[model samples]
Target: MPFDQPLPREVKVTDSASLFRLEERACDLSLNSRLDPAWVRANAALDGAHYLWPALWNSLAHRPEVPRQLRCELLITLRAGDRVVSWLDVLPADFNPLPRVTSREEGMQVSQLLDRAPSVREWLLREGGGSGQQ
Candidate 1:
């Protein structure tokens, strides 16, 4: 669907995790919406085999001014399969470290988390998985 296409509802942003709520107010516009969960899961079977996957996504996300590719990948991965009983908690890239809170006022945990790139990457791997594609 086009980013301009309106959804049935919007998910409220009471918390960053709400980013994945997919309710009317919850989602941000995404250019790579074509890369949906079903597609990713279907293609994950070809992850490493796709010679230009990351580069292709980077071009779309960075060069073309689309949504962040890594973020999109993470989001899609979170929604894939997930036939398990537990809910797939899609963490807003903004929140991190135990007991942390994110908000415009009085919340400064963000800077520290950003500074620790390794931890962030590890989190991505742990959550998104080392080879998540489909």
Candidate 2:
């Protein structure tokens, strides 16, 4: 499929097991007290992160071609002494596949982010189609 065009109705996927393997080898994209943009960029450039779409659709390969969606969260430490919590859901059927932040939070004192949840979605589309950072 062409990268410039919308995602096709069906995508060829290896398998769910393959996705797990990719996830196991993927990096953690969670931010702690400091919001490092470079970390997000670097991890997004990684091979595992780049192939997130294939992994995300691997399980649905067998089912009828339909929208594949997953809700995920990203924790970012704001420079203003607060934490900006972002939630996004990935819809691979769209032309822009990045997990755009649908909800946001502020001043939440929390640590240890759930990195894997958004890495597959956020990391892949961060540089291409989205405007905010996690």
Candidate 3:
């Protein structure tokens, strides 16, 4: 999906290999979105066990051209088999990813974080987000 497109709410993967692919896709998307690749390489890390992997991109917040309302963070959810494993946060420069949380409570926390951003909240309210396309 294009950067201008709406983000997906969740993504499903059957195994660790698929999860790794998802991480790569997320990183590629972030780079394509104009996030600094070098910064991403330096700051982005893979955490959690084989069932879950969350990736975050926070470079956009540093770009002045990006609007405040739209500067809301972005997250990509990762699932392994029948369970939700982790989430990726594509955040603004000013914000940091929330500490890793168990999959059970992640959905609610993601909602809370997105709600903190005006534009993101409106997008979620306007259109139910989905797991973004590869």
**lDDT for residue 31 in candidate 3, whole number 0-100:** 34
Which candidate has the top score in lDDT?
3
lDDT of 3: 0.34
Question: Regarding TM-score, does 2 or 3 come out ahead?
Answer: 3
Q: What TM-score, computed on C-alpha atoms, does each candidate reach?
A: 0.24, 0.22, 0.27
Sort order, lDDT high to low: 3, 2, 1
Which rank order by TM-score, best down to worst?
3, 1, 2
Q: Model-by-model lDDT, in order?
A: 0.26, 0.31, 0.34
Instruction: Please list all clashing residue pairs in model 1, or write none if there are none.
Output: 9-24, 10-24, 10-25, 11-23, 11-24, 11-25, 11-26, 40-134, 41-134, 44-134
Clashing residue pair totals per candidate (backbone < 3 A): 10, 0, 5
Which digits, one per residue and each the tens of the lDDT, describe model 2 over residues 73-129? 434332222223343333444214433223233111122333323433353374364
Stretches of candidate 1 off by over 4 Å are 1-17, 22-105, 117-121, 124-128, 132-134
Model 1 lDDT tens row, 58-113 = 22435454333322212222233221111122223322221323353423332332
lDDT of 1: 0.26
